[model samples]
Target: MNKELLEKGFIPDEICKVLPEGFQDIEEIASSLHKILANNQITNAVNEITQEKDLSKLTNSELERAMLLYSYVGHAYMWGKEEVEDTIPENIAVTWYEISEKLDRPPILSYASYALNNWALLDESKPLSLDNIRILQNFLSGVDEDWFIMIHVAIEYEAKNVLGSLKKYYLDEDFENKNLEDALTSIKKINEIMNRMPEKCDPYIYYNRVRPYIFGWKNNPATPKGVIYKGVEKYKDEPQLFRGETGAQSSIVPALDALLGITHSNDPLREYLDEMRIYMPSEHRGLLAGLDKFLEEGPKNKVVEHETFVNEIIGEVHKFRNKHLEYAKDYIFDQALKKQSNSNIVGTGGTPFMKYLDKHLKETVPKDD
Candidate 1:
């Protein structure tokens, strides 16, 4: 029953950061998205590329790489205009949808395409810290945008140790308190990295530049009906609503919650968290669900006796969630009130977050004594 996670944690191994020669046309434009959008060339430049390239011919990693490029290109084209675009043009729409189908996720940008699979190492020999990392693609690149996503990337990198500890605690027969101890240590480290979010990613720059491009058509005042995929037949030319990329989609928190026996009330926030599950990679979803199921079926005596460890986990989660709520207010909610309408006050993930984040933080209590 000892199930081991991948060396890279929930992140994909050997992600295709760069597509191959056949995709040179798309790759070139994707690399310069920030510049292209500034010059107002995204629409015409994107429209010119045909969708003759075959996706089935691509490897899974390449398909992921394609998704990364197409997502950046799609978001840039849609949000880049001085005026908002209600319809995704045929060229971007058709190709992006195809890639989405292959990846089995929505056509719009998600966390995987945005941060999980969207990084490169400045020195592969070194560790995956911010010093060694560089974002592969960006809409309007800046310290704010780079730090926002890179902070996420850093947190994801740190979560591997958390997952490693959980794997041992769940599957290893001799699962020890050391596993829980290590998990809490990693959990604390995760919060530490998160607290540094404001260092370079200022609230104003994040709101005006980074946050704008990630908003999905769903629940958005700018594109309330969502975006119409002009040529994707499944929609029949209707507006399709998808949530924007949010940190909730990351597998790390869900895994930690499952490990610590944390549960949320059956409410809108819980429902929204489930909705974000669809956007996660299938294997990562299995990890969250399977870990929860494993706990329900496995003997509880081992973990129950360690009330002290459980309290430590709860406290760490509380710390992380509290910091998250603060970031939500400073980085998005307050900023939205100043610049955006009521609809956009929702989280970048396309859901009301203020009340939910607070509720989730309080719900991070210890298991019944």
Candidate 2:
């Protein structure tokens, strides 16, 4: 529960692309994933990887790469083609599930894989920004897909600007008002970064190409009963439901919500946000837990600046949520429906996000009760 994020926010300090010789085959598949998908060679290519590779003696870093590679390949196998596949092959399923169990998250693509651990700096000496950063993986490569992930990376970079202050705010017994104020400023800046999404990634392209590969089995018509993992004993070959990679799984907003005492209305969306906590890295989830306890008697005083700080924080939250709602409408809700896979009604996270996001936006008032 200690403040582990000093500079990187939720992003790992490095992507650690270098793996042991055992993982070389998996790494090879990940390198040309788009080509494999284009030629419909995913099934055999991925299964062959687990055959020789003994996952028993790998490092945590190696497992992370396993998650990343398997997730990209799994999504591509399911959604890369015209029709969705219902069953995950045995080797792919077992390898993905084993690594997922080691990581304590579901066996599907989440935000951590999509953006948090998916980027690398072009110039190591330079700061982490869109200009210096590039993604390590892709679904079906395109500007729309690359831009979509990098934009999230940019926002994550900006969010870290507040982490030092937030860490101080969390650890200090006094709940320093200065720390809170500094974080409010960075939160406002994070919203500005989010505004740049449409500058390159066209909403049309994002809704179609970029989003399809990220959708999970839950609440999805393509795999209506969820997905079956062929050889994973934990599932007994039953279909398992897991939400897809979504911003809801990101820790930035949730940490702010816990800190600033912002509360969403009691609804399914609230439940969904709570459910997303499990998808996040364990440390982030612990940070939120610490903040909730830290605030019990903390933020302890109500000085003149306290009201102003709280109001400004609330204002930024409003702006962030409203802007997200606007983007949701443009990027997903209002876009023309082309395929059953990319439904305008349901989000990639496998929820009726259009309805819930609008409600969640309206419910974000200047003050919480």
Task: Compute each candidate's TM-score over C-alphas.
Answer: 0.95, 0.91
Off by over 4 Å in 1: 1-3, 6-8, 295-299, 340-344
Models, CA RMSD each: 2.0, 2.6
Error of 1 at 99 (Å): 1.3
Q: Residue pairs in steric clash, candidate 2?
A: none
Model 2 bad stretches (over 4 Å): 4-8, 174-177, 294-299, 302-305, 337-344
Q: What digit string (tens of lDDT, one per residue) describes model 1 on residues 202-285?
A: 999998889888878777888877889888888899899998888889888887777667888787878988888888777777
Top candidate when judged by lDDT against the true structure: 1
Top TM-score: which candidate number?
1
lDDT of 2: 0.78
